[model samples]
Target: MRSKHPPARAAEAGNSTTRQGAASPGVQFLTVPADLAGQRIDNFLQSRLKGVPRSRIYRILRKGEVRVNKGRVKAEYKLQPGDVVRVPPIRTAEQAPAPVAGDQLRQLVEASILYDANGLLVINKPAGLAVHGGSGVRLGLIEVLRQMFPESQFLELVHRLDRDTSGAIMVARKRAVLTHVQGDLRAGRLEKSYLALAVGKWPRGRRLVEAPLRKNTLKSGERMVSVDPEGKPSETRFQVLERFRGATLLAAEPVTGRTHQIRVHAQFVGCPLAGDSKYATDEANRAFREVGLKRLFLHSSVVGCSLPGGQEVRVEAPLSEELESVLAELRSGTGVPLQP
Candidate 1:
């Protein structure tokens, strides 16, 4: 899971790219080899990825990104060597990309109603809060939607956002746009862009991390990511915009769609998301939390595409105040920024 396509061709579904939200994102499923079947999940990935890495490998394991026996399994468990490792579709910004709720969220829907004909509602989604429901998340973007638009005939998500991510989200008022958009994403047409706060310093200029990603599953269904040859191909490009103490503000463009591709790739290169608890060290998480960084430090800044009928739609949203505050602290050179 690396990147989505470019901006111009983002919306041309009746087969030329930009077809996301018309249907579920397209996916190709393949299983790991049985020859390396009996090895431990982590060990196998580590060996296969020679120049890749171990921390990322182990992290993928914890996320249950990697599978054994054709289903989700732990990393510590010994593989029978031939056990099939199922690599699930990694979520780019489109993954679990739930919408935002609150007075502000409603305002966005009403304000950015690009084209609301026949049940297709395209609006910018804010970072944080999921598009759908999941563990530890009760009220999500869609849930709040039902509260306000209760009588609407159809209000379903075309995709998702990580709990901390935000950006262009597509909603299907009717089933037609939903079906078409999903089909388009599958065909690799629609694309998305994101702005994130990364941990640590970066190279002097634009950099790219391209690696095959394999999700490693650990006990209790924890999933982590890593760069491995035995894993599916994943790529990420970064442009360092600003550098702060122990962190960098970057505009990351993922080439292949993968779970935490930006996060994982950043961490793989020694720069996890500053406020991320899933991949960063406990100290960093604690430090950022003290500075009012209560949420993930990623934001989906813009989304656009060419639609049928020669319509081009683009939506943009700002980063959350929480993240903004932290950036301000970094910018102001505050005394060891406070945490949440």
Candidate 2:
């Protein structure tokens, strides 16, 4: 990343004093390509902004810094191909800052590479790790990825797995590749699936989840998801694969990506995942947690996408052995009736 000490200009000295923020007010222009036309403004920024957080993209839109074809567009406005977009200069020091991950976390993320081909890098992210730094999380997987692959200039994430969800993550080795892959994802041409276990004898069969997700913040500041029409639409197609004593192991395929969409929707349908402490009921959560179900029982098991070379790549990361063992214990304990 280039470090340009703002030219000591009449622009607010206090604003430019900080060595960081988002889009350097030095101002840059982005041309919407033909394939990516008709995408939403916020989604467009989410893909285009290099390091800025996705949550903050809407904030920039409200600031009028993102203009489409010389006019401000709504966050929901669909962008047309070849639309000229102006990305106003921001104090680089404030918005999309550099990685602040500690040494240990950085080392772990760098060493988890599964493969690297051309302008695409593959990583097997472990559970209990965040993909990027956020929400007071000091170290995320991407922080280390950047530290180790600095020479791979223009590195960026094609998609996010989740904070606690572990699995194969794909990174773009080059900027053009990043944008191209994102085009495929936004067009509903990309596919990713997860493996999970749900509690309480679910009906044997495949089920489709059509849940609208809305963010609801708890008093403790922890955010959660709930079913609300006002919320964003989310879908997950699930099929029961195995049945435990009181649980059914299933394969979850999320059709639409939404925060906490899978976990919340699964619970809403009457079967909370075995170890989900956040949305699971007290009895189910406590009973499972006692048997070593400490973290959320969700793993992004597979990632599939089309590369710039026109080749399809699919990678799978099995669930952690520890989580699997915990599931075994939970199933066995139900029959033995272990004392609390």
Q: Best by lDDT, which number?
A: 2
Task: Give the Å error, residue 322, model 2.
Answer: 1.9
TM-score between model 1 and native? 0.61
TM-score of each: 0.61, 0.74
* Model 2 spans with C-alpha error above 4 angstroms: 1-100, 216-221, 331-340
Estimate the lDDT of model 2: 0.70
Local accuracy of candidate 1 as per-residue lDDT tens digits, 1-340? 5324322223221122212234424322223343333334554443333223344446667787765544676655655533445433333433232334678767755664544664567655655656654345545666666657878855666655676675667776654455456556556666667888776677675488887888898887677777788998888888898877767889887767787788888888877887777888878778777667776787767655545444566666666566778889888875233231
Cα RMSD of predicted structure 2: 6.5
- What C-alpha lDDT, on a 0 to 100 scale, does residue 146 get in candidate 1? 64
Report how far residue 283 has shifted in candidate 1, in Å: 1.5
Q: Can you write out model 2's per-residue Cα lDDT over 1-340, one digit (the tens) per residue? A: 2223322222321122223333454555566666555456765564455566655666678778777766887777877766766655555554655556677766667677776886888787887887765567645666667677666545666788777777788887775577677778888887777888787776656499898999888999799889999999899899888776666677888888888878887888888776677877777767666667777778777777888788888777766777778767856755212221
